[model samples]
Target: LPATVTIDQPAVLTASAAGDDVTCYNAANGTITVSSPTGGSGEFEFRINGGTWQEGLVFSNLAPDTYTIDIRDKNNPLCIVTLPETVTIDQPAVLSASAAGDDVTCFNAANGKITVSSPTGGSGEYEFRINGGTWQEGLVFSNLAPDTYTIDIRDKNTPACIVTLPGTVTIDQPAVLSASAAGDDVTCYNAANGKITVSSPTGGSGEYEFRINGGT
Candidate 1:
C-alpha cells in the first residue's frame, strides 16, 4: 500500500516499503488512506519521533512547532525509512488603544485632556478625533469643553479600522457673595455733602478705615 500525507506549515518525514513493497511520503495533518496493490492481505507499521510503530490511522494536531514520522511495512522486514522536516508558524498582528477602559467619569471642569497609548510594541503613527471631527495624530487633545465626547483612534498602518473611546466633562458656576461686612468698617459716601459718613454700630470696634478702588 502506498499513501501520501499532507501537513500544516512546513515539515519533513520518511516512508519505506516492507513486504508488499508499499511506500508513503508527506504524511502531514491531512488524510492518509492506504490501498493494497493486489487488494490482498497486507499490513504496514507507522511510527513518529522514532517511537514504536502503531498499526492504525495517524492524525496530527500540528501546533506552532516541528515533528518527524517514520512508516514501514510489517510483512517485509527489509522495508525501513526515516524522514526529517521543519515547520514554521507566524504570529498574528494586533493593534489596541489603552486610553479608555470600562467607564469614564468627570467632575466640574471647563477643559480636559485624554491620552491614548498603544500596547502592541509596533512603532507607528496614530490619529485621534472627537465626535467624528478632524483627526489629530498622537491621540492628544486640549481645551475640550465640558460634555460627552466620542473619541476615535486609528493606526496609520491600518487606516481602515479605528478604536473608539467615550469620555465626559463637566463645568460648574462660580460662587457669589451674599451679605456686607460689619460697619462702620463698611462706610457710604454722600455726594451732596461731599463727605463720607462712618457710623459705628453698637458693640462694634471704633476703628475708622477708608479705601479707594477697594484699596486702603
Candidate 2:
C-alpha cells in the first residue's frame, strides 16, 4: 500500500494596462484588467477615494482632481494594490482693467482713455471693446466720440471671462461760445484801425473763430 499527498498552490494575481495617459481631456479615465488567479478563483473589486468597494475596474467621467484607486480580489480583500494619480483641468484666465482721463466738453477736447494693467490671475493678454463693437488689441481706448459709451473688457486667452462697464466713457456737450471786445460794442467808423479783441470761449477748448457782419 502507498500513501499519496496533494499540495494546492497559492493564488497569484496580475494586472496590465495600456492606453492614453491621464490629462485634462482624458481625466484619468481608463481601465485595469486582472489576468491572474486562474480558474476563476475570485472576482475583481475596485474603489476610489476610499469609497465603498464596487465590482469592475473601469473608471470614467472624472473631474479635475487627485484620485486614489485600489484594486483587490473579492475573495481575498487583503490582496490589493493602490494607484495614485492626478487630473488637471484647464481653468479660464482672469482680467482686470482701469480707466484714465475724464469726460470732454467738446469734440476737440482731450478724449477719455482706459488702460488695462497687469492681469491678476489669468493670462496677461487683454482686449477692449466699445459699444459692443469689434474687439481691438491693447488696453487703451483713446480719441473716443463725445457721447455715452459702453466699454467691455475680456481676457484674450479666454473670451468667456469678460466685464462690461456701461456709460463708462462719456464726453460732455460742447460749451456755448461768447465774444467780447475791449471797449463798447460800437466802434468809431473810419477810426484808425479800431482795436478788436476776443475773449477765451467758455466750457470749450478756448480756441474759436468768429465771423463779423457775416464776413471773415
* Candidate 1 lDDT for residue 75: 64
Worst 10 residues of 1 by lDDT: 18-27
lDDT of 1 by residue, 58-116 (tens): 43332222335455656654465443332232222334456642222223334455556
Candidate 2 RMSD to the real structure: 7.3
Report lDDT per candidate. 0.44, 0.56
* Per-candidate TM-score against the hidden true structure: 0.34, 0.49
**Model 2, TM vs. native:** 0.49
lDDT digits (tens) for residues 74-140 of candidate 2: 7788877664343233433334555553555565566555554444444656677877888987767
Off by over 4 Å in 1: 1-94, 100-110, 118-123, 166-216
Best by lDDT: 2
Q: Residue 63 deviation, candidate 2, in Å?
A: 6.8
Total backbone clashes of candidate 1, pairs 3 or more residues apart or in separate chains: 9
